[model samples]
Target: MDKRILVELTTEIVSAHASVNEMSREELLDEIQDVFRKLNALVGVEG
Candidate 1:
C-alpha cells in the first residue's frame, strides 16, 4: 500500500472525528473501527 494514501485516509478520519460534536464514545470507537476496515481493504488492493 502507498504510504501517502494511508496518511491521507488517516487525516480524513481524524478530520471527520473532529467535526462530529454529538458522537458518543461508542460511536467514535465504531467510526475508528470502520476507518481501519477501509484502510485494510485499500491495502489489500493491488496497484
Candidate 2:
C-alpha cells in the first residue's frame, strides 16, 4: 500500500474518533500514533 493511502486512512480514523469527543493535544497525538502503529503492523512496516 502507498504511504499516502495509509496517511489518509489514519487521518480519517483519528478524525472520526475525535469528532465524538474533544481530545487534548497529547491525546490527539497518541491517537494518531496508535492508528499509524496499527496500520504499520498490518502492512508489515517495521517502524
Candidate 3:
C-alpha cells in the first residue's frame, strides 16, 4: 500500500469529522488508526 494513499485517506477522514477539534492527541491518533484499520480490512490490505 502506498503511504500517500493512507495519509490522504486519513486526512479526509479527519477533515470530515468536526468532533476531532474536541479530541485529545491520543484520541485523534486512535481515531485515525481505526479508520486505517477499517479501510485496510475493506480493501483486503495488511496493515
lDDT of 1 by residue, 1-47 (tens): 76566657876885677696677778777776677668867675345
lDDT of 2 by residue, 1-45 (tens): 777778899999999999999999999999999998899779954
Candidates' C-alpha lDDT: 0.70, 0.89, 0.75
Candidate 3, lDDT over the whole model: 0.75
Ranking of candidates on lDDT, top first: 2, 3, 1
Which pairs, if any, clash in model 3? none
Q: Distance from true position, residue 43, model 1, in Å?
A: 2.3
TM-score of each prediction: 0.52, 0.84, 0.66
> Could you give me the TM-score of model 2 versus the true structure?
0.84
lDDT for residue 32 in candidate 1, whole number 0-100: 67
C-alpha displacement of 43 in model 2, angstroms? 1.9
Give the 10-residue window scoring lowest on summed lDDT in candidate 2: 38-47
Q: Which portions of model 1 miss their true places by more than 4 Å?
A: 2-8, 45-47
TM-score winner between 1 and 2, please give it: 2
